[model samples]
Target: MKLVKVYVTLKESVLDAQGEAIKSAIQTMGYNQISDVHMGKYFELKFENDYANLEKDVDLICDDLLANPNVETYRYEILEGE
Candidate 1:
């Protein structure tokens, strides 16, 4: 089996209001050391077979489901097990 880990986040130029709100709350709670918080999404996918075509399938998933190519950026890693 192959395990895929996907991470999706807004582009640097895009505004992240949710992340800002969380940072503000943290600061109010006396956490002043943190700065520039960014929000992101994580997804884990398991493939039942065809390890040889893993990269192609993962690219398709990223393009079609996991990420919005217009504004969001994403990266994925594959873990193999015996």
Candidate 2:
């Protein structure tokens, strides 16, 4: 079995209201060293031996369904042996 770790984040050109709010709140707490923040998502896709090429499968899933091409970008890593 393999575990696919997928990370999805909005494009840098897009505004991250939630992240900006968090950064602002944090700075108000007296930690002023913060530069920038971006909000993102993560998911784990588990696959058994039934898949011969899980990497390709995961890429297809990300491209076709899991991520929006215009506003979002994604990257994944596969962990095996569990």
Candidate 3:
């Protein structure tokens, strides 16, 4: 078995309105040190397959389902399971 971890976040050039709103709210409560915040998504996949082909499969998954390549960037890691 293998465990796959995926992270998806907005591209650096993209504006994160939701994050900005949260940051504003936090600052309103007196957390002034928060300069910026970016929101992201994480996924954990459990698969009973060979790790050799995992990267390609994960990339496909990210491109097709997990992320929007136009506005988001994604990265993934695979770990051997016990």
Q: What would you estimate as the lDDT of candidate 3?
A: 0.92
Error of 3 at 72 (Å): 0.2
After best superposition, candidate 2 residue 48: deviation in angstroms? 1.1
Per-residue CA lDDT of model 2 for 1-82, tens digit only, reads: 8788999999998899999999999899998999887889998999996798788889989989989989999999888847
Worst 10 residues of 1 by lDDT: 47-56
Better of 1 and 2 by TM-score: 1
| lDDT (Cα, tens digit) per residue for candidate 1, span 1-82 | 7789999999988899999999999999999999879999999999866777888989988989989988889999988744
lDDT of each: 0.89, 0.90, 0.92
Cα RMSD of all models vs. native, in order, equals 1.4, 1.4, 1.3
The order of the candidates by TM-score, greatest first, is 3, 1, 2
Candidate order by decreasing lDDT? 3, 2, 1
TM-score of each: 0.90, 0.89, 0.90
Q: What local lDDT score does residue 22 receive in model 1, on the 0 to 100 scale?
A: 93
Stretches of candidate 2 exceeding 4 Å from the true structure: none
Question: Of 2 and 3, which scores higher on TM-score?
Answer: 3
RMSD of 3: 1.3
Candidate 3: residue 79 Cα off by (Å): 1.8
lDDT of 3 at 18: 93
Measured with C-alpha atoms, the lDDT of residue 29 in candidate 3 is 99
Candidate that would win on lDDT: 3
